[model samples]
Target chain A: MTVKLYDLAHSRAGDKGNTLTLSLIPYNADDYELLRVRVTAEAVRHHLRDIVAGEVTRYELPNLPALQFVCQQALTGGVTTSLTMDTHGKSLSYALLEMKIER
Target chain B: MNERIRIGCGAGFSGDRLEPALVLLQQANLDYLVLECLAERTIALAQKRKRQNPPLGYDPLLERRIELLLPDLIARNVRLITNMGAANPLAAAEKICGIARRLNLSITVAAITGDDVFHLLSGDEKALETGQPLTASGPLVSANAYLGADAILPALATKANIIITGRVADPSLFLTPLMHEFGWLPDNADQMGQGTVIGHLLECAGQLTGGYFADPGMDVPGRKNVPDLAHLGHPFADILPDGTATFGKVAGTGGLLTLATAKEQLLYEVMDPSRYLTPDVVADFTQVRLEEVGPNQVRVSGGRGQAAPGTLKVSVGYDAGFVGEGEISYAGSKAVGRAQLAGAIIQERLRDRFPDLRVDYIGSTSVHRTSFGEYPDPYEIRLRVAGKASTASMAALVGEEVEALYTNGPAGGGGARKYVHELVGIVSTLMDRRTITPQLTLFQS
Candidate 1:
């Protein structure tokens, strides 16, 4: 069965310079392994291809059962010089969550 | 000294609420209150304000905050640490002392200066990311190093009623007190790591207490109907000498401080949990555990880390250019079509002047940039156009062209608003930690 990433996980985003950091934690702890298996750096880059211009690095924390993605060139420019209404890219987490995933 | 130091973060950012902070002060019975009111771009903007008026570089809200909190703060005896000083800590400290004097209270305030290392920056220093020279953007306005708890400890040792600093790490403002209260040397990596975890979790103030965690779902319950959001109390932590910390909000105050909220805030802005770099320690956030001990109470512990980085991050601000923005609302039938046509017309009209002009349909395809495939049609859409230009007048062209859509191109466009702002650009670089020195100044009322 297919499901929206939002159904399985919750996330928040933060920015520093041109990079955006998004941390995703599953609502159900048992789904951590499934998310880790499916949500790859390449998959995320493909999912957020419109927003992320450069590299997207993913880090895993088994203890917290969370996945953190650091996407470079994600902010267009940093807070100082971005033309977007959401200058800090606070809405990027929802954008990432909009992606579809197979359950 | 107490076995556990109680600390509360009053303000998350510069413009955060005042009521919640008063709640923490009056009810939480905190030993220390930290207000992290500075962002990367704030100091650069504050530097310009200081240049215009020498004694006016501090946060404009400094007087109001101190004035509002001074009497209560003195009566409660909770020491305050804040980076609300922005570009000028000395002036901010004097301003707080002045506020204390006006409140008919006796207090000592200490200001930590020397974060502004603009003079030390050579023109050729490259930004940390692209390795491109920072001055390549434009002439430098301000460059401040991210000072750590070390910069603040000397001032914290003075037992001042308030301590103000400029351009320190948000976590450092909280960590300094822990270091001072616990007498933990900066070299104590484990304690520094554990304390940094607590600081990071609490740094965003209300975010730790469910201000930003409001999505109620089938799986995640009891979040959407966060009771009395208007009175949502901020958070405080009680950390023991053993490195375990329990976070809770004031009893009877609105907002939840459950494990879910703590888990969300645990990794809010952090990138690599294993190598979370700060001036003090390379904090390992990966091992930290968040468990709900009781209602609105979460126990946090088991954090680890390594040594501090030899280099400190420097936020360099330069005049990038200006950004002009215009937004107009379209309503009723065929609104999306009119907004689409409006966008095309402005894009074509400003093609020569603003080659990189951006158009966004607010009700639909605004934030995500692309709508995956095709999004649902909307009954109304707000058309926004924006672009960057070398000069303010040049940037103003974007908004002006968008407003021209009222009669020139599209039909039924209303509620148009235009803005032109000189954009402040911030880039990061690293400097040898040994080169930067933090100095402290004291003011008494």
Candidate 2:
């Protein structure tokens, strides 16, 4: 089954004003080649409380083949229920009901 | 349905010591029972079991323990679950079923599987270690993916008397069954947050709500009683329907579960608070708020969270450096302070002897003392030195300093000591967004 789950705040917002940022690199590039993608100020405003701004100014690295979303904040419990929260900090009960998991 | 349900966890870090935490559950009078014991090294031990002629996995310690307590739990009708099935959960089910038949107890044993992702990486063994597109390891000893609570939900639905799993997320032990009974699901982040809070509070048994809290007014012992020799208390948490949870020790148990104690356990072995990722959920520790609601009860709530990514990251530690620990005490005027100085001296000597050696201390003396960064300590200092590098003989070198403490320091009676040898390995693993899909399994025995 296919369901749409929200990517983490910064991941969905992309690189912009928010502290969380994403980077891209050539498939065969070394770890150092990782390049940061700059998000628009508008995108930053969208992810303010969700994340903080990085100290250094970052360059935007666009995706050529496919758009990638990198979650800066942690999330888990794809589906479970509990008065207890999962390790990722999200509650399984809320996550399962809200998360559209095709099973 | 909204009424409070008391869940008791069985099995602890140690099985040979402390009167078996499982037995205490009977006296505590709990509603549900959980047994937890899954460590990185335990996986290696489970591998050894699978390598045997019969290919048996880890022992069914919980099932055996349950055999003794089955009458009590059945009398009270306490449903139970555990992650004791380290590698071969199917085999574990067979053992549990054997015991159930002997006792004539109608027990529904559910085995949750499919999280053994390591086996899938066999053809491409290298991809398993680095988790990189392509990389490898020395040998495929053992591999078990950390499953989430949702996987256990199906098992709980079977109306099983006991749910057994392998390498489930730590908090999932407490969260899954609670969710199954309450009918809560993914959309319940707030409730999940509450459950996460409960798991965090009870993660270390009695640490929260008073086991570790040194409340002077409570007449509790210092470090000696942290793992109390006398009657250890069974800690309980009361979770409200409104997404708040309160925790404390079982009435007359020895330890205390105060705010201080609870806070200490919250930060244990944790790397980040914002995305407190467990095998089950990504709990936010940044906004967690704890208050001493009563003498021994701490109300824990207010842990906000973000949506988890579609992928789950795995960590595998590889060869990195050597870690050796040696302790020498100076029993003079500035005993503690001098021990600290000697620790520094030995560290410096090791570093000087092998400039590349990375040295550091553990226990109360180190910065990374507690599991998480939640608690602070004002205790006497204990020193440990770690060396990381290709050229560092950390173990043999550190051993020399342990011998030097008596002669180098002021006339403090320093004696010979032994060093625990530990190998430092680099933990590296990756998350496959595609493989991140959640699975639910329920088996009948």
> Which residue segments of model 1 deviate by more than 4 Å?
B216-225
Query: Highest DockQ among the candidates is held by which one?
Result: 1
Q: Ten consecutive residues with minimal summed lDDT in candidate 2 chain B?
A: B365-374
Candidate 1 lDDT, tens digit per residue, B1-445? 6698899998899899987888889988889988888988888999999999999899878887887788888899989999999999998888887777887888999999889999999869888866889888788899999999999999877869999999998888888888888788888898889989999998999998888877756455643447777788999999887779999999988888876677879888888889889999999987888888898899999878799999999998898889899999999999999999999888888889887788899988788787888577888999999999999999998889888888887789999999998878888889999999999999998
Whole-model alpha-carbon lDDT for candidate 2:
0.50
Per-residue accuracy of model 2 over B1-445 as CA lDDT, tens digit each:
5666666654444252234354556566677766666655554456456667343675536565657766666787887777777776767776777777788766667777765665455334334323443224333444556667767887766777777777666787888756875776756676676677677556556444344333233222342234352556656666655557777566655666654455546654343445667655677765667776877677777765555445554433223334444555445355556666776677667776545433323333232122222235433334444443333464566656666666875356354554534332222244553674444444443
- Highest lDDT, which number? 1
- The Cα local distance difference test for each model comes to 0.88, 0.50
RMSD of each: 1.3, 14.6
- Model 1 gets an lDDT of 0.88
